[model samples]
Target: MSRSRPGNGHRGLDRVVSRRRLLTGGAAATAALAVSGGVLGADLLSGASRPASRRLVESQPAAETAAPRQRTVPTPAPTSAPTPDPRYPDGPFVPGPDTRLWGVFEPGAPSNIAALAGVERAVGNPQAIHWYQSWSGPGSELDPVRLNNVREYGALPMISWEPAHAGWGTDQPPYALARLAAGDHDDYARSWARGIRDHGGPVVIRFAHEMNHGHFAWAAGVNGNTPEQYVAAWRHVRQIFLDEGAQNASFSWSPNIAYDGTTPFDQLYPGDEHVDWIGLSGFNGGSDLPWGGWLEFGPMFLPSYEVLVGYGKPMMITEVACTENGGDKAAWIRRAFTDALPNVMPRFQVVCWFNENVLVDWRVQSSPSSADAFVETAGTWRQRTP
Candidate 1:
């Protein structure tokens, strides 16, 4: 929640850290966290989240000649069978850590990555602070030398919002989804939803995120526009920033990673009563399964987000990645936050890491032995359980 880049005195602080990365293959079609105190009973729902079975977990694979982005989708049941009734939400899930894990860069590279040691031999996980480079300029618009090459090579500028049929990168058909479901939002969805409706701050407009397992093009999603019409187009872009009075911003529905037991998180629900949090899009790549360290693989997707646990809201991973560029994949980043981040940090609240580090020629750069195991898994992943 910081700001001040207007003309460049450069104070900066509109912190909406829950990131939403990916554009080519719109990132492995799905995702995969959260926290809070009190209100936890029910003798801990069979030891907190466990229903979706047969866990496999891997990302960015399936190439032979269909490499525009792949992982086709198949890895559900880490736990989710819900239906014993009694309107759910019990005990023992203890949860903590409301999402924000960082990474994703390419704002017109120049490398001095804040000072550059050969930009860590070419992007060896430089702790990123958002750099997917959308729209480019105006208002929340940033580029001060790519925000000083993301805080001089360590990592901070977050941006990713598109969904008037995704436009800027192209997707809005059906007569621009019938003029944004009859409300008529244009100008590229009013320049990323009118800079958070007018300017309340903390921007992270994650729209049409993983649309229930399709490759890209915002799924053409329908139920007669009844995923509540994508939660009423995110409550009409959160009521056009509360009727143009404008106030920063916050809205993420992101999907993917449902480990198919015949697919049904309510056909990718955008209605947990109009979401405010719950984002899961994972990545581990390098195969051979098992990557427990990034919070011990967060119990492989906590039984498929127990069907959005009665909408108590607050969960993130908005977007994530590993590589098609291959091997040693930064030694699976400290067992994924020291052992799958305590089984998805009790339904995560903030965990964003799409750190850019390509190999091929998406602009020439190569450094994978998984970047010295992602700097030793970001120094013991926030010292275990806090």
Candidate 2:
């Protein structure tokens, strides 16, 4: 989905093409080499890399440092492994063999159930409900009400947790990646960790998503942030959650599909030890915007997918949609769920549809044909339950 910047007339993937060059041919190959820290690259990874001596806090046997924020009663460990639910033998939120989970993100969903239900009726029951949360905002306190609503509706709560200001602008100094790693936001991070621990259920925290895209403050080289700082910030935050015993919250590291100029995966990834799932966000803007190129689902994501799948972690297309300008949107939807999602990319366990009107009419209900196409193949995708 295009991350719509409200005040500025800019939206992700829809930004002016000249500024964010979408390279091809030899240029695309060079960029791919740069992503892997090839000789052509300036030492972007040098000095910024995580020290070889620092161990993940969870890997240690016990808490090795004092709590940086207020503490709560420690979360108790489970006495026994859960008797796996029939619908989800692997575990809650874990997709079954040959099964792919479907998720949706309506504009007012998880709070406005009536609006969310409208989408659910058009598509089948979604296995996950995707939404956003900012570190500093009026509605940011890990609201139990919102979480409960999604839980009651029988869908997993997938929160795209941004560390920036609530407005999600491109430059926010207070929420800088450096400050986050320096223990500046421990109080806030810890509170949410404790809240999830108390909630006693599964929640997917998509922290600092699409870090390769320069649309947000958290992206590398934006707002004075660097890939090294991003890695540190992620590991630091995940460590705090572990210290608080927030085992129920799973962390997903998402990046925008690797456009030519975006930051590389190796530079931003915290490591396999720090992440539970790998996620990629991509949108086909078609010919509706300046940078929108008409590419099929496979081409739009294949560059990044080739790299992320190598990480050997469960993968998800956290945000995806198509615009109706240059192609048959209905056929795209049909081909995606029917063939591309299942056959072309089997490692991707979750596919979340961006059902909003941002930039262009990206919603499946944008047209009768588009809506019908999605409904026809919706039931074929599989999901899990607690």
Best by TM-score: 2
RMSD of candidate 1 to true structure, Å: 20.5
Q: Where is the poorest 10-residue window by lDDT in model 2?
A: 32-41
Whole-model lDDT, candidate 1?
Answer: 0.39
RMSD of each: 20.5, 12.1
lDDT of 1 by residue, 178-257 (tens): 45556765454555455433322234445555555433334334322334455455566555644544333344566755
Q: What is the per-residue lDDT of model 2 for residues 1-386, given as tens digits with 9 covering 90 to 100?
A: 33344311123544323223232111111111001000100111111222311100011111134556655877666889665322111111332344456788877777766676667566656667788777775666788877777755656678888887655577898889999999999999999999877765567889998787687788898999998999899999988988887766778887777766777678888877788777877777778755546667876777777766766567788888788988899998888877777677767777888887765887887888888998787555442221
- Residue 85, model 1: lDDT of 27
Model number with the top lDDT: 2
